[model samples]
Target: MNKNPVDAALILVFLYPLLKGFLFKFSSKNMKSDIEEIGGYISFIIGVILGTYLTKKIFMIHQDGVYAKIYNNIPEQIISALESKPLLIYVLVMPIIIFLIYKVVQIIIDLINSITLYPLLDSIEDLLKGKSGFVKRIIGLLFQLPKGVCYVILLALVLNVLVIIGVNDTYNKKLNESKLYGNICKNIINPITNSKLAKKIPNVINDSFKIVIKNSEDQPGNESGKTIVYYNGITLSEGIKSNEEIDSFSRELVKNKKTSKEKAKIIYNWIGQNIEYDYDKVDKILDNDFTIKSGAINTFNTKKGICFDYSCLYSAMCKANNIKVRIVTGEGFNGSNWVSHAWNEVYISEENKWINVDTTFYKGGNYFDSSIFKLDHKDRKIAG
Candidate 1:
């Protein structure tokens, strides 16, 4: 009557080593060999995980300078070709680093096991020479438990990833029916991932990669043949990436705010007061000198950016507070003349409607959820 074939399969996988030990008659030599094999596999898994962690840390801390110096000399054409797929950099570089670290750790563990570990086990076995059969079997099972647990953890991780990626609805449903998998994810993986520390972990991976989907219909302000690239499920001007500083700062800014409207208003005030309009960069951009970098990270760090930067930073902060916001590109009347500009449209859950916000013009007037916002701002394209 139990509806858990997946759990049954997992249980068998977990007991595979114990069954192996039984088949080998629980000899000290066989037990020692199995433990050594498990140790090696465990070491490899640790290496892979550590390698991935360290690689992400290294990139987060030193990606800008290191990446520039290393990739600076590449041909512009090649760089341009790869620009459309920035995710490729992580895909190609991360694996090599992980493999090297994994190999090094595996070799060290192998050497240690060969030279000292096996001999130590043999010595222990000699001392327990006259142990009762029951005791020996219990010890053997105890030794095999690590391998069994490791297999279960690894399988749980794989299944969790499959569910995240949404490979197949039926497959995911079946995997979810496994109580063992659910418990491991809920009790172990989820706690670790949802912890405050994990929440604050830099969006380095997200920053490095943007999932792009082309918009077919023609929209104003968005140039023809341009693909819509998204970062963290929000539409953004190209090159706007988030980081740990921005993530933590955004959360801190909204920690005390009660409502989404209140959070959005306070964020608006902070940006207006803190982020200075970079007139020089704006002039350069207007002159077609597109060398300056501007985005959420840039604005958060330098406190200087134009309309696009303002809107991107605003969207990122609002998103951190669970507020639905999108970067809207259009023409805004700048007193003297209407010019190409970017702003935000925030969805207020209380009102069940989207409202306009232009943090760039925050200094001039109340641009946060104000009716006057529509008078100067003309609608164009919402970054999808």
Candidate 2:
């Protein structure tokens, strides 16, 4: 439950790949400095940078949802721990201590290599005189372990360079929205972009476009859409006009439900089983030709919509039941494509925490993680 993404990423960069040699019997950089110096310093620097990023991400990542409970109390936790162990500050700097230990070990490794490597390799070629088999080739490749290690060290840096682009919000936004990143699912041929590749190599990159993986697009969501439905003489969009209907819907679901969770589950099941997704409407919504008033009012009236309709309609029902509810906006992945989504967050006093409820996903078989509407859902904003 560390839940520190940066710390996890740092370990992947500095320790995970290197430790692969020990864990899976596999696994590596510098010229001005030797391999040991380069590796030890690189690992320490990366660790420090990631540790810094973790401090920032923890506060910012969980600002708007049930997940906020994980990080919002972090300050209190630190205070309590410090109260128990007055010298907790020293423990927090353990990474620095570990770095120093790495440096000492590196110095020893450098010394051992300097003293023993040359003498060991001097007449080693003569030992392999008649060896022409694959084993000899393998052994010969093993002799270049120093170079392999250096290459891996450099590879780690290259990988982190890609990662740094993602961790920074400004860079990430630019990348995700860029035409360079959005090279549509359709393949396109262009003169300037394709000419250079065609000349350099024949079809080396047949699919010559930058690959970018991003969460679903940003949306303010149906909070505004709900208001749009109020223009006329309050039709289906008028939950107030439709109060009797809402009461009827709730009577069947919330009856004899003494607890908030039970009421929420009954509502969830009702919607999941009754309402359906309208695939034909997707293209219209994207084209902006569709009506925007398609909110809670339109949803219950129609009983079918995209994610927006599902969330707004669900919130409207919860409101009728006298339950506290909020519409949440974010993105989700259903194992393949990532798309913008809207869902509900209901406060159940029994749990004393907001439970994520993704009615849209309830159709996908099972969608019951209150902690996260979907393991793939990432909370981005509150009401909108």
Candidate 3:
């Protein structure tokens, strides 16, 4: 009849084992086994609580330090993997550590039990064998309650961590509605989370997400690629245009150009000098009020577009001139912060190399084949 039925249900769940243990009359052998089972549960509870705490502390304190130490030594491919999911490596590694801790604790408890605890439990069971059911129930209840409390505390700690790591709104709402769970969180879990170690947890998660966005290359199926493509995590439409117009314009742009590198440079400089960044489109895109009005052709005709437009237009021109090129979508630094941007990586047959080109940043400086080009332009994926 409690107002909080969910809380009542949880209480019943925890007490069910106690109730069952007391209600059923076990043989002497079964009682000894049950007593042994309690020891195993205690060892398990200790392992889970202590193992989780230790694992969290190690990562919270040393994760960034570990990342820094290994960053320079590893290959760029592996560095990209780390940047994509900074916490994932820790998640994978923690289970092994926790398992080792659990095994160690189990071994110690087994040793102690063999030495004295098991014999004492056996003597106690013998005394209880002739006792009334009511007395047995009381003792069983006493044994079960402590274990139940530990289970509740462990559940509370897990819930708090889930909240900090940004659990789903619906789950959060349901959890908040549970008065019993809320109290457990506030009184029991909040103190531990209020510590300096706990405060760093959210920061670590946020920083990891930031690193993923900053360093991630645009890949065909990457979620980070989608995030870095447009404002407010919008996906940029591919700036598709017919070869006819691009071919005609490219031929004029690279008139009498001797080599592929020459043609690529001409197209890069032309897009940079002529096409203006469409600030209006950026504002409308952020508000989700913009429509894709012919990606490449619109930009070519209007002489304006965003980073995606610049890259697309450049790519079209390069293809017209038979240069191997791709539209790379990823985050770009605009002096202060990284944002969704696009650029080009053109393959120069003469140099036998691929170089970055950012026509969107044309006015900023010479981004074409610049050595420091990768410093800002994170190549996420090839759009074309």
Q: Using TM-score as the measure, which candidate wins?
A: 1
Error of 2 at 295 (Å): 1.6
lDDT of 2 at 45: 45
- Candidate 2 overall Cα lDDT vs. reference? 0.49
Kindly report which residue pairs in candidate 1 clash with one another. Answer: none
Off-target runs (Cα >4 Å) in candidate 1 are: 58-83, 86-91, 176-179, 186-384
Q: How do the residues 1-384 of candidate 3 rate in per-residue lDDT, one tens digit apiece?
A: 555554765586577766766676434455556556656666665665565555444432223565345435557775466446545434564556667776787788778867875677678788887789888777766666655665566666566556544446555455556778766754555434333333221110001111123324556656653444332232334464536877897898898889998989998888878888776666665555545453677788899777767777887788777789887766664432234566789999988998888887776545788644654555377655
> What does candidate 1 score in Cα RMSD to the true structure?
17.7
All candidates' TM-scores? 0.47, 0.40, 0.43
Strongest candidate by lDDT: 1
Give each model's whole-structure lDDT. 0.64, 0.49, 0.61
Higher-scoring candidate on lDDT, 1 or 3: 1
Higher-ranked by TM-score: 1 or 3 = 1
lDDT of 3 at 346: 92
Question: What's the distance in Å from true for residue 241, model 2?
Answer: 8.5
